[model samples]
Target chain A: MSCNLTEKVSLLVDGELSPVETRAIERHLLTCIECQQARADFLNLRQQISAYTPALNTQVQQRALASVLAKQGRAATRASAQAATPEAGRRPARIFGVPAMPFAIGMLITAAVALIVTSFVFYIVFQQAERDRQQATNTQANSSREQTATVNQPPNTNNDNSKANTFGASDEAANGKQSVDQSQQQRARGPVNSESENRQTFAANARRVRSKRPASSGTALARNAGINAPLDLHVPELLPPHEASAPRYITINATAPVAAPVRPVDAGTLAARHVEQAGLLLRAFRNARTVEQDAAADLSYEKRRARQLLYQNIVLRREAANEGNVQLASLLDSLEPILIDIANLPDQPHADDVRAIRERIGRKNLVALLEVNSTALARAYE
Target chain B: MASEDAEFTMLFQEFYPSLCRFLECLLGGRASVAQDLAQESFLQLHRTVWGTIPVGEARFWLYRVARNLALNEFRRGETRHRLFDRVVEALRPRTQTPEEEYETQERQELVLSMLKGLPEDQRTALLLREQEQLSYREIAEVLDVSESKVKTDIFRARTALRERWAQRVRAIGASVR
Candidate 1:
């Protein structure tokens, strides 16, 4: 027969019972042969199971431990490397040998600079536009003043108008000479008849001439015309009618063409225009040598133009230097020697002399330089 | 950290052998698989919960993890066919005399067959109690079952194995006759 205490034999062998419970189980086991046999079987089973598998050999244990440690070391190294460089597995893209971050920063800086330059250009353009608008207003006002002066003139001055209009259409240099003679004659006659009106007309004419040229040159031109004489005022009543009419006619006609409004040219625009013209002249001069046998006759016009350009170049170079335009000033300085060489050429320049100038032009690469600066300055100021 | 590693190493050295023996019986006498699962259990403990386990619970924890691994291997069914090969490998003679080695192998085969005959849970509980010498409560902890269940399982496993042992002995006597 099976004993109920038989199951407790398993727990008892495992020491799961308390001391009192162990005592009771032991007391029961003493008399119950079946319980006693169950306990023996459980104890025997433990011994059998324990001996079923052998312990790993010493060498195997050490090797297993070493493998574990080695693996752990490698894992630790990999983890630390990952921590040190987070992007170790995959690096970021680059542009033109520059890394992404710095390239992006450079692009941002360039965009900002371009934005500032664009705004500055807009500001200059607006200022130039405003100046043009104001100049138009002043031109209209000056034209009204001239019409008023013409309408308020004496009856004898009508005949003088016809004479003045004729003079206005004549050669500018001859008109300037006739003005000088008329001013001297008026000074000899002394002041008479509406001196204020004559003085007003004379002052207006002087201002008109001054507006068309540079300050120094305009002043010298005014002196050459004798319009600078303060006492040479027209006095119609103090003179013969013909003599009185002559001063007003000469003054009005001599200054008429000069009175039309001329747009003020800044040094930059002037230099750009000069470079453009010089580039054309030099290119044509170079092409003419190849295209024509009588290049000397064809070059006469260029030589005369070169002399005029040379004078303008000296003045412009000084202005550019004073304006602190080193690039333009340097270009003009290089151009000056070439202009002098062309201007000093004989009426029929020798083939050797022409070749020397052409060689110098090519050696300096002045044509390309001039073309680039010309377009650059025109784009900058336009 | 060094002290922690030292402690883990000490734990590994102390328990690795017993754990392997426990898993050997659990996995039907597969010694190599038992050693692998045992080492894997220790590695898992180190990786996941080394410093976090309570002091005495690491042994229970290791057995639990190893038991789970062995369970997974059982589910794969790959080990079933390899069971005979592994039994043969385990019984392979080494340093013992031929007569002693034969007797040892015979006894080991008998014990392994009886142990394998028990249900999986009962076998695991019984092995944890008998082989590891764990208390019923410790077996409960390792198997994550109630202590009463552990007690019942071990008792049932013992009764079953005793019956099988008696039958085998009687059969041997009959064959001798």
Candidate 2:
């Protein structure tokens, strides 16, 4: 067992084993000479270690004691500090620290709340701005429409004005109160037969005055011969014989009251005057279109075309801007159905020829328009 | 100082030295670094009790903490401390003859150096048994090993130590003769 058994003996000296195991190991070592020697050497080392009793300095021990007492006191203080913490499901109280965990959490919560509040405010403002843009677009459209209507139409009658007033009030009530009503009403009158007949009468009176010219050198030749006499004239077809004949009766009847009768003009003079008079009637008839035609040409070609395109552009842009605004889109949608109705209507007289033709005439008048200009067609009967 | 820190300082002063001495033995006489490691162990204890670390399972927590710190020190390699101890031994009061002291010091160093060669589990078991005086159950708690395994590791460690010592003794004797 010599020095070989020293490590085992040290473990034995430490009393690491149960009494039974210790006894068994001890019994084996007693008879063995080398083991006995190793046991003595281990005993010598143990004795030396045990003999060196270095005392712990008193101050060091006291310091350690004080540290332990201080730790206990701090632990008690910590316990109280912990008791102040709010439990689960509780709102935290303000506490002091440089970026304390609880304070950081509270700040994070407050930041999140503030962000949500700001976002909500922005959303409301965005909605309001969209509404304002839509309202402005509607106002511009309405003004342009009124301008177009006034330029194209005659003075409105009492009945038409009353009807427009009633319609405006009713339309306002049906929709959310209108900022402006952009639609215009154009009155439609029947064929205009009476007006054309009045113009015919006026043209006849003009012919009568032109035939009454005192210089009748051509008139005297025309009165001397029968209807078979050949007289070259600019307008022989228009002067029914009676219009030229009436002036002779007037000259004969005036002879009783007159001291000296005015001398008659020559045949050439009579012929030229009648031709000039006929040309005047034709010019009047050709130029006699109602004010509405002038206005329709002005508005439809210049103002309405530009204005309509602008309105269309506004509607398209607004539709894009109102992508998610249901109210705005619906408002635009309600107005879209009426655009064709408004556009196809006439500028005056309450009749919408384009609309009536589109509905009733269809292709019936398409081929007819090739030969008939609108102004010519309107003036044809007159 | 804050009231809490002042209290903590008093507690630190009380526990530090003994804990250091205990760690010195646990880490196989790594005495020079023992104080810092022991202080670190107490800081963990303070943190745990104060709810900086969650509290619960706190009693005997310091012993476990000190043991872990010692093991961590071993793992970290105490080369500077070992060199420092060698220097201190040259200056400090010593009761043993220079020859005996040298031999004893060499043997202790030999044991510490050899500890690296052993399986980590076996070395840990031996240290807990010899230095910490931990019961089998307590050792089991710290190592998270079965009690029987702890016993076996200690036995294996002792056998390895004995074989190593015998070989060293034989080599020394042969060289001397």
Candidate 3:
């Protein structure tokens, strides 16, 4: 084991191992002194190599930036000059050679249009400012509520307090009825629907992650990730910490839909849904194999939801933040085939397939990420 | 246009240090060359239709162009080892530093020389993988190679360095004996 696992040791250090394989390697490393020495050497080598970073001179960088800006400015000036003239040796294009009265009418119409556009823009701006003010006041409570649910939020400015009091009376009524039905179902299923269970867990975890790395990584991760946290940027920092830090577990409540407006899922929203959905799938994959082998955990809803998200992201040209997000979307895209296969399986999934799923989850370190993000969400909930 | 300028500035600030370090590794430790190439790369990006390209992909494009430029210059002067040695010597402080600092400097020089000894692709691949902490796919994107080739190149590079380190230890052991 000591001699043979040298290559595997490298893989282990690099985290190129399934949970099962990782467990095996850990157990082996406990007794293998030779392997331990190899690990030390490798670590030392890494340390020495990493120490040799080239210094960046800020003067050179500033100079470079100015050069770039000047170049861009020159190009833009050229473009603008070209745009100013329609053609050489030709008069300007016109709709017609009409009377001065018609030109006066056109001027009046243009003035009216401008006035209307200005008014409309002012109204939108006012609404946005008003919403921002309201959000600032409710930041505390809404942040706490974030633990129990993540919504298909309509722009952060869509503070539903006014909506709950005003429009969409029928929509609220329908949602209330659905909530009742879900509550009734939960009663039958026992305490599995404990609303604050996940909230309390994630909230605590968020605090822990916040405490662990207070400076660079901690703040960027959205430790107390608000309900309206945007995945618009493919910030690896915004994702769960990818460092090989030990992840702590906390309970997160299932996202219970409340009386909120149901915005239709666009491509961006669908990708956001998958990122959310990936967390739950990772958590489920971690625990499912151990629990009485009840393969049909009724993930049919999530399966369908994830499948819909997949279709929307792919078919609708869902612009991810970047190629990093494209990779994530592709991972989610690959999950559709797996979900379809999982749906077709019998009540109790075959052990082999379950192992395959777990392996996929472990290889991606999805469990750790799920823990990291859930912890962050819990902190946000607080 | 102001927003675009700010965007370019932000990208420059974020990537400048890492790009310079990566270039230094590729161009055999010439810090000035690394700085120039990195600036030129960013300058090229600034001149491009950056809105059409993804930021991550744009970063890889910078690395790719810098790599090509370095390789071209290397071809012009077939003395990569001499270049590496010159930079290492120049970078070494004349006055004595702490024992730890000296050891670190020596280790860094050894690493650069070991890096110099490897094939160009293997060296580039290894540095991208370990130094920049880029994923194999990312290294592949930057180097314009297949993912499998990136993996093989990294593996070969690591093995060579490991063997060299082992050889050094064995030499020290024999001398002591």
DockQ of each: 0.13, 0.01, 0.16
lDDT for model 2, please: 0.41
Per-residue alpha-carbon lDDT of candidate 2 for residues B34-125, written as tens digits (9 for 90 to 100): 65566556656654453233111232465567767777766777556467765534543454798987776665566565555677677666
- For residues A6-40, could you state the per-residue lDDT of candidate 2 as single tens digits? 44554575565678867876986877676665556
Question: How well does candidate 1 score on lDDT at residue A71?
Answer: 68
Better of 1 and 3 by lDDT: 1
Screening candidate 3 with a backbone cut-off below 3 angstroms (N, C-alpha, C), the clashing residue pairs are A198-A251, A198-A252, A198-A253, A201-A251, A202-A378, A203-A378, A206-A375, A224-A380
Worst 10 residues of 1 chain A by lDDT: A215-224
| Candidates by lDDT, descending order | 1, 3, 2
Task: Residues A1-382, candidate 1: write the lDDT tens digits.
Answer: 3688887776788777889999999999889999988888778777887777553554455466667666665655554455457584486434245334432343467567867997997688667766665544444433332321111233443322222211121224433344434544443332212446445534344334323422221111122222322222222232244754444322221222222222334556777778876775676556443213565655775687688789999998987887677988999999899999988888767788888999999998998788778767766767
Which candidate would rank higher by TM-score, 1 or 3? Answer: 3
State TM-scores per candidate: 0.44, 0.33, 0.46
**Residue A126, candidate 2: how far off, in angstroms?**
79
Flag regions of model 2 displaced more than 4 Å.
A1-382, B1-22, B25-29, B46-60, B74-104, B114-116, B132-134
Q: What is the TM-score of chain B alone in each candidate?
A: 0.89, 0.65, 0.83
Global lDDT of model 1? 0.64
